[model samples]
Target: MRDYVDQLKEKRICSECVGEPYLQDQIEESGQEAECDYCNQTGRTFTIEDMASLVEVAFQQHYERTETQPDGFEYAMQREGIREWEREGEETIDVIGEAAQIDVQPATDVQEILADRYAERDPGAPREVEYEFEREARYTPKKHDDAEWHTKWRQFEHVLKTQTRFFSQEAADTLKEIFGSLDGLKTQAGRSVIIEVGPGTEFTAFYRARTFESDDTLQEALEAPERKLGPAPSSLSKDGRMNARGISVFYGSSDPIVALAEVRPPVGSKVLVGRFDVTRSLRLLDLSALQEVEAHGSLFDPAYVTQIKRAKFLDRLSRRITIPVMPNDEPFEYLATQAIADYLATEASPTLDGILFPSVQAGRGQSNVVLFYKAARVQAQDLPEGSRITASVASQWDDGLEPHYWVSEEVPETPKAKKADQYAHFFGWDEHNPVTQDNRDPSLKLDVQSLVVHHIAAVEFRTTPYSVDRSRIAMLTDEENRTGDVPDF
Candidate 1:
């Protein structure tokens, strides 16, 4: 048996000195451990005299990190230490939280990343441009595609456990019986709709209710909130014999991924599970959608099917080389290239590990085909200065002046414009003067140039909004150009 005294709050103290912050207990992002000479752990809120809590956590990790030990104290004694700390009369201050990492690169710059393709020598090559960030910003998974999103698989597992806690095993069993698959569970949904859990929402509540427990525990945990109950616990507890939190499983699947993203976790919960279904818009073997080759369905041959799969978009998704994509929109051709466009519009250059695309087009509702594009992971420093087309001179956009932005080199390799390199933005749109400098708005520029978009060589092709089939172009480096047509997205 364990005994403990009640928490007391005297005059407020600053937690920065004695420790005990909220962040102390929450697991840190992978590879990042919290460390503070004074605080027990980092916290976000500053509350009065709440510092007594540190003893509970420190009693374990303090010894482990310091001694570099292999094991921690036994649970029995660890409980005792917590009890002792609860009784200890000490004064500590309120805790404060430190800001998390931020991303400074702008979306526009990354989209304009130049490669080695050469053109008709409009300008030899694009020169480096100085960049400056006006402010500080960070990337959220919601904002861009992060392939390394979850460092540990357990992160997903824990969420399931939390939600399961909300329901009783009997309920889950009943649900399984009625729905047949977890994918089919529904709300008071009249016979056809499916239920979905939200992203980042915990399953603890569901699981707790499900686990076998003592009658008393069951009664206490399952007792409906008083507001819902009429007068007494007995009367209120049995609202048709069940109660759940934020679970509206009535919305069934047309696009399971989109439905999940929209109604999950019952609309109100922490960012517990980033649970979104993957929707896909599969590209059929026939590009024309009308052309047919083999007589009597010989098209099913593995070799023939393999050729179609090799198309740029499908191949990319198959390899997990996905980029940021507009989720659940109308179906479009070459879905993979769209993800790249999405990534360029949202994240900074080379910042994300990959992108995930959800489909909502014909034949691709709940099934998501993910593409993990690693292009963003490459840095300017990875290549020599002569070859650096996208690296910035400074690390931050707001880092003073001069080195404010990622630098783009002059394109002696392709521009005819006097100061061509000085004015180009993502996808070749000079944010400063997209009209005159980009050559897109012919009326604005002196030369009436036809701004034809193509992803070709360094001869000033300024390919805006163009995506090249990476492998196809790569093959061209060795394979003959054959028809001077680089198969671009």
Candidate 2:
């Protein structure tokens, strides 16, 4: 017979004798017919040895021994001179009863059984030491060494900013691994980051804004506003959050207000905003959706601990990619994101055309988009051959009323091709032609009716203020304070 059974030969626990519903059910289903010692009633019962095994398993999984404190005055002083201390844990019997939700008598009996077992292993060890539930420690998984992967990103950024901007093997390898891993990640809702967007989709249109300081510039833009407001040509292209110098990419927003805010127009300047329709289907990586990437599994699984750490790192990385960068820091701070954008556009599998990210200027409920050079081409309006077009803006105001501004387009009559000739040319022309005015394919069409002009009268700022505190200090030499001590010279 087991030692516990020999020690408690007269004690047997039944399902009805235990308070925990799960433990009660477990005993009732697997226990044998015997009289319960505690209740003094005949029913299904488990031997004391069997009950001790269950208690031991629970202790191993949920309890940890408290550490012993040092015997020193300094340590005691730090603890506020409280020298006499008990272990920071619950009573052994109370812990066992509460953990299994068993009645006091049965819990005490189980505690005695465990105490005897502990004594058998180490005869000189104390049997009264308290035990704490490993709640905090269990939740804090062992740290996985992710420093190598994290250092890769920092190294890549450093190389691009200081050493090599054009070609760096370290940057390329790091980006390849990152993109490869991200490509397989999915949102908690099981949606891929690469989403299809265009006509008849949730993201059907994008808005771009431009600011003008003078009437001449505004008028010049109105003449061919589609071309003027579109992505700038390589010669005029400047560095941006996701595009380096000489690299042109379309930067727009889902919300017109966000688009206007992004340009940061001066208080006295005029801003023109236009909506552009997504002409066809395109693939874009949505960075905001990365926040929902899930890392969930049973706590018992060792592999899940590493996954949780990686998921946390990914959450931080997603924030870093989209966080706003100040204007002065853009030159260096944008290198990492710019490199990511370039790689996704040219080298990523399935060929992404653009990226969608949260708008830092407008905060939540707004999103910003960037279409790479290949997908930034805007379609020009089709007009009759030799047709002359002119644009005019009119602003009128009545007394005590706000001024209203509007634009009008005028077209002059021109020669037209015959219907038969037009049809013949359209039908006979080859689908593939090398000759073209613009080498790139069009991906966006301007929605002329959605144009609006905003006159900036004031700028608003949101700020947090801190009060300044001041203190004064004075220094004196022995000579300056020698009223009674001149002998010291």
Candidate 3:
């Protein structure tokens, strides 16, 4: 008998041996039957190694028969250095023991096996998969009914973050033309600058007049003057246009100034005698006035009160000037009074390389003089014969004065182009002045020089508004009443 088998036989009696004090007492009394626990009373003997195998088999059977896993199954597997797995497609079990692999049949519980393996490795950590509902719920769609409120907020943010300093390249060019330099512009990195312009109207004029052989009406001439933006270059008059510099004077009204002054030739040059024409119209409008027109009226003839009101011309002129213009970024009002003050200061303390005039006022429909550092002039033959738009003659005035008329035409929207158009329109109107006659002989061919004004003394800005009185237009006929002094032309 194997030693282990003998030990087991001595420990317990066979089931077939009837009990007395115990199964051992029955075994002792009957001595006719010999039994072994390992063989189930077959009376077979086994080697020690065989007994150990039987013990393992008995324990495995107990583990399988239990409704739940044994409490120490994972611990015992780890202690014994054993690992269990199922064959890929079969019910047979493969066990990896300390030194070799063993096969056990019909133990194909993969999930349970994996659970045991995880439990052994992690002890008490969770073995089932978990999900976080709140984390995923964040991406769910939301509903809201206040769309207008949202839009308002969006607009607020847009203006705050993006609208402050952003403007188009064209806008910058226009601003530079006005300020005489881009160094005066304020901006942020990678952002363009927006210029908030004040509402006002500008009037411009030219000295010499021209007539085109093909066309007679002033429309072609009024529209023909090309805008000269930026500083006046030396080549400005290369094509035989008017070119002049130093200070220049401009009258604010549309009335013909030919009777007052004439463009005389250089001492030895040809006499440049031509008509005097003055064109006036609306210029830039403020932000508020840029909206759709409230009423439709005549685009010409300011004397027609309906047209003036419909276009909001007076309202735009009355708008307050509050935007910054200088390179120092200071807000300034372009009042005629302030302009005179600034001129005084500039003159009192002149800088060697600074602007000579130092300041110019952008008045609101006020009669004012412009100081041009450089301007050019040419004879009538070099330009087109401009068109003339005639309004009803102002006949309600005193009989001694000549009848007055308002000439209107479509001018460019820009300050510079509109000024150029105004200049071209009046080029030849001076010679045609009904009340004035040219002193020079009409047969002499003439060349002209630019109209020049030496100082602010040449400018005469009126504090009172332009006379809407047709009678006043006729009444103001005398030489002194028309233009105070001859501009240096």
- Top TM-score hit: 2
Quote the lDDT for 169 in model 1: 48
State the C-alpha lDDT per candidate.
Answer: 0.24, 0.74, 0.27
- Rank by lDDT, descending? 2, 3, 1
Q: Top model by lDDT, which number?
A: 2
Over the stretch 1-489, how does candidate 1's per-residue lDDT look in tens digits? Answer: 011111122212222332222222322211123332224454333222232232212212211111111134444555667522222211111001111110111111111111111122233434442111101211111111223222222232243344443334443332222212212211222221211222232110110002112333222212211111111122222111011221111111223223233322222221111112222211111111111111111121223222332222223333332232343421222232332333332342323222223223222323232212211111111222233243322343455544222225344454343333321232233546647342311100101011111111222222349666654335674434666777675
Q: List where candidate 2 sits over 4 angstroms from the true fold.
A: 1-140, 143-148, 296-307, 394-439, 476-489
Q: Which 10-residue window of candidate 2 scores lowest in summed lDDT? A: 133-142
Candidate 2 vs candidate 3: the TM-score winner is 2
Candidate 3, 56-127: lDDT as tens digits: 332232212111232467657756778542112111122211101111211112212322333456556553
Compute the lDDT of residue 125 as modeled in candidate 3: 56
Candidate 2 positional error at 302, Å: 8.1
What CA root-mean-square deviation does each model show from the true structure?
36.7, 9.8, 38.2
TM-scores across all candidates?
0.14, 0.65, 0.17
Between prediction 1 and prediction 2, the one with superior TM-score is: 2
**Weakest 10 consecutive residues of candidate 3 by summed lDDT:** 132-141
